[model samples]
Target: MASRARHGGQAIDGRDLKGKAVISGLGLTEMGRIYGHSGGWFAAEAIRLAIDDAGLEKTDIDGLLVNQGMTPLPGMGGVDLQNQLGLTNLRLLSSMNVGGATAGIMVQYAALAVSHGMANHVLCVFADAPLREGRGGGAAYGGGGQQPQPRGMRGLYTAFGMFGVNARYAMAASRHMGMYGTTNDHFGAIAVAQRGWAAMNPLAQQREAMTLEDYHASRWVAEPLHLFDCCLVSNGGVAVIVSSAEGARDRKQPPVYIWGMGQGHPGDLNRAGWDIETQTGAPLSKERAFSMAGIEIDDIDVCQLYDCYTYTVLVTLEDYGFCAKGEGGPFVADGKLGPGGSLPTNTGGGQLSGYYMWGMTPLAEGVIQARGQGGDRQASKHDVVLVSGNGGILDHHCTLVLSPHPA
Candidate 1:
């Protein structure tokens, strides 16, 4: 087992700090829309519930973190949230912005800070109503309170463009089904499998069961990626509370320890940065993460990879050593990722089925698995799990390895 490296009675080396920080509590508002709640109100509800879950008061929180909301409210920063929540004093704070990777990154940062005694307890919050945003449903302020500048085609695209780039690069390597018998049907299987899980989750946005046929017939958001392959905008908030393992054990729920966590962003836009054809980016983050947990890929029982697009999951599967490069398509075939498969994934329906708080929901799902609250979709309930988050066209990535307490 990987033990925390201690120097003069203090843990060192980011990867080896096992069971130092634990998830003491979890909370979420109903995933879909709230007819009466403003965004701030929704956020407050999540925070209050989390504190209650942790069996602590807002006064216990000495650190604060908030997900970057799409629209900036009158007072929407760390200080603003602190004042609204009545947290007396905050020792550390930030608004970590890595898009979908925010929640996992926040947890990692909190773990390190708490382990080092920089702060006692840290609360991470993610709340959003993307549909209320201008592009999807909210206000479009344009630029300088005026119309957005014309970047021609680039200006028009949103998440669509990100997927476009990932798909284009993925297709370039695979050559759109040459030699191998892979087709979009293989990708649809991923969607179908997730929807099956979502159907059982009352919290999922699109709980209607989908067939491979349904996935194929869906409109094309981007070539090689159908509408179903993409995550939908949702209005909801999720919260997690992290504290020292000793304190977590006294909480209402079983503590899920942060065994390993790693993040990597090798800044490279061109081909030299990564090989889209080979689907290899930097594996250093995962290597560090797995090493931290003192476990290997074979030791993990479930995975909740960031699946903004099917291609991203495929790439991550290979990069993380779940399957050999280019084998992800075949690995997911034949209903392998669903209820009884080897790797029961996205038990909360993920961003695909559950709420989309810029991917915070998926991180919550990972924590859900570690605590064995997977309900009907629970898999092996094994000791170890690996959850990954990808942001900004796979530009930013993080991996978290969680394990249940040992008897």
Candidate 2:
């Protein structure tokens, strides 16, 4: 039998680390398509901004964690960032690639480091510049490397023209519709609602007001997935500072306490004997996070769900227990995810309508909401926030619960 903690079972409650660490600072670069900037430049800029925001200097940072999305080029990993920033003293240094789940897992590691006295102040940074005009852009999936295909898998996928991440997610959405009576309009509602939130964020790339009609008229990238349903590819970086709860209390901003965290990885979708349409790793991750936090889903006043696609958000809503299984379509059809809705989600517009920094955008938004800094899109009750990250074709899942007060 599998170990209890392996499947996010009840064995690991995370009580020992609850409220031991907090996010003291959050910083982001101007998010948009930049023609002449490298990923390291953006990462450095974000790190400096975060250190300044935390009211600390580089000398105070003894730990670093870097998440570089889909770019395996040399001198872009954690050690490269340390050298770029010229930090001499370091205790913990690491790099992570969990697809979109990188940022959430970064925080989990940061908390562990601080709680264990392995590091004093940890800087978690993420940067990506995948889209460049004219020249063929770098690969956006699988870290710019080719994966080994099984005997017949390549031929089968090629026959159906099912290449890349979009087609795989499209298949998942199609299966969801067949089983749950979900409609394209249901997915459209998510795009429209997040775009509405994006319209309020000055840093958002797609801030233009989009109506349901506009969403329906948008070009289809794949069956049941429109242009607006997809995430925007832009150049940006984000940095967050994690410190002990006692140290965070003296920082410049209100501390966003780390209450609980959990991670799970369902088998890869590319492999055989995996059902991409009916199953995701989110439920197990959610169970462990909520169990560790000693709170239920209703306690979350705000949510920053990874929005790589509109269907990603809908399936997460169902998997995270915000609504009944297979009832995500009807649950979000009433503008419940928009501003002033009963469940305010993706207040920063998410990757779909906001800038896409992979999972970092959602983590930054969660900290802002917990600190009560979300200007117009702030949730009415910003006490507890639920943040989720999805990697690959729903293969990896990470969940975090943030609160304004310690547990």
Scored by lDDT, the top model is: 2
Whole-model lDDT values for every prediction: 0.72, 0.85
Can you write out model 2's per-residue Cα lDDT over 1-407, one digit (the tens) per residue?
A: 12346344446567777899999888799886776888888888999999899998889999998898654424644787788779999998888889899999999999889988999899999988776776432244412222345246556665555668888788889989998999989999999889889988989988888889999999887888888888887787899999999877767888899998988787764566766565678878877788778888889899999988999999999888888889999999999999768898999999988898988989999998998888988787988899999998888899999999998
Error of 1 at 273 (Å): 7.1
Model 1 segments more than 4 A misplaced: 1-15, 73-77, 132-182, 271-273, 276-282
Q: How accurate is candidate 1 locally (lDDT)?
A: 0.72
Write down the TM-score of every candidate. Answer: 0.86, 0.92
Candidate 1: tens digits of C-alpha lDDT, residues 1-407: 23545789976555548789988878888876545556666677888888898888788888888875564433645677777888887887787788677888999999888888888779998886545433442122112222245355655544234333435434542542453455787778788888888887878888887899999999875566677777656667788888988767667888889999888776655655454443433375686787677787888888888876655666677788877766777888878777777788777777666656765776778778888887887776658878888766566788888877731
Once fitted onto the true fold, the runs of candidate 2 whose alpha carbons sit more than 4 angstroms away are: 1-11, 134-152, 268-274
Once model 2 is optimally superposed onto the true structure by TM-score, how far is the C-alpha of residue 88 displaced, in angstroms? 1.2
lDDT of 2 at 310: 94
Error of 1 at 381 (Å): 2.6
